[model samples]
Target: MGVTGIGGFFFRAKDPKALAAWYAEHLGVGAGPYGHWDTQAGPSVFSPFAADTDYFAADRQWMLNLRAEGLDDLCAALRAAGIEVITQADWDMPGVGRFARIHDPEGNAIELWEPAG
Candidate 1:
């Protein structure tokens, strides 16, 4: 049988509990013991960038992109919480979607994507 979907994404964290808490609080991820999150059924992107690509931070090896809805409200909430959210006009595509960037407490680059409705 072919693979259905991503099973998990594991990574090293300096403070596992704190990091987990941060994800759950800010992005509503990694909530339970198994870090399982129920996501809406939709398209998921799977692509790798070149080593020298500046699409994300060069210092980091990977960036996390999350699918979202009601991005305007979410961006406002994050801003009100004092988190820096980055958006640029060029990053948006006509048929693809809108994009925003933010870093976690440990400076991991995260992309929030709101697909066209």
Candidate 2:
């Protein structure tokens, strides 16, 4: 009838083991005995920003787009944990929903988006 949901996100990592550990410590994502992430619920959005994206400055090498169910809540959670969350006025689309950006320990930009749910 219709497409259901995303399976997984794959990206190149300079140090996959280290990068994976950073994500696990900061964003709560990485393979665990609990079986992946056991929080929140929603269909994830998968899209890529252009190579010359002004959305992320040139110093950053990669961009990650994440799908979150409670966008605002997650933003607060990340903020509370002392992570630098950057909200872009231009990135928010009318009906599609909103987007916020942040970087990993390795300085890779990650775009977190919440579609209308």
Candidate 3:
């Protein structure tokens, strides 16, 4: 059978517990052994970029793109929590969506996307 959707995302973290906590506290991502997030139904992008791509940091092997709603408020909350969020005018595609970027405590790149309505 064909794959249905992404089941999980596993990664290495210098401090797994702390990192999990950060994700839970800031982005509302689930943490702990039984933590699970129930996401809304929407489009999910799966693409491989060129080796020299500058879409994200070169040192990092992957960037996490998450679908979001009420992006403006989320960005504001993130900033208020002392987390830096990066946004660019050109990053917003006409019919695609608006985007913002942030990093975890370990410097992994994460892109926040709010699809065009």
Candidate 4:
């Protein structure tokens, strides 16, 4: 049978328990023993970039993108929490969506997207 969807994402962390707690507090993720996060149904993008692509930091191998709603409020909340939120007008497309960037405590790149209505 064909693959249904991504089952989970596993990554290494210097402090697994602390990192899990951080994700739960900031991004509302990794809520259980196995780090199960329930998400709303929506379009999921799976694309590979070229080795020299400049979309994100060159030193990083992967970037995480999360679908969002009420992005303005969320970005504000994230900034108020002292988490840096990166936004640029050029990164947004007219019909596609708006995007903001942030990093985890471990310095992994994360993209937040709110698709256009």
Identify the candidate with maximal lDDT.
3
* Model 2 residue 115 distance off true place after TM-score fit, in angstroms: 0.5
**Model 1 TM:** 0.96
Question: Between 1 and 4, whose TM-score is larger?
Answer: 1
lDDT of 2 by residue, 1-117 (tens): 886665456677688888887788766785585326654566564557678877677776556777666778888888988888989787899988889988886678888888864
Q: Which residue pairs show collisions in model 4?
A: none
lDDT of 4 by residue, 1-117 (tens): 997677788888889888889888888887866899888887888999999999999998899999899999989999999999999999999888999999999999999999988
lDDT value for model 2: 0.75
Off by over 4 Å in 2: 1-15, 33-51, 59-61
Clashing pairs in 1: none
Candidate 3 residue spans exceeding 4 A from truth? none
lDDT of each: 0.91, 0.75, 0.93, 0.90
Error of 4 at 35 (Å): 0.7
Q: Against the true structure, what is every candidate's RMSD?
A: 0.9, 3.7, 1.1, 1.1
- Tell me the tens digit of each residue's lDDT in model 3 across 23-86: 9999988754565888888999999999999999989789999999999999999999999999
Residues 1-117, candidate 1: write the lDDT tens digits.
Answer: 998888788888889889989889988997877898888888888998899999998899999999999999999999999999999999999999999999998899999999987
Question: In each prediction, how many residue pairs overlap at the backbone (N, C-alpha, C within less than 3 A)?
Answer: 0, 0, 0, 0
In what order do the candidates fall by lDDT, top score first?
3, 1, 4, 2
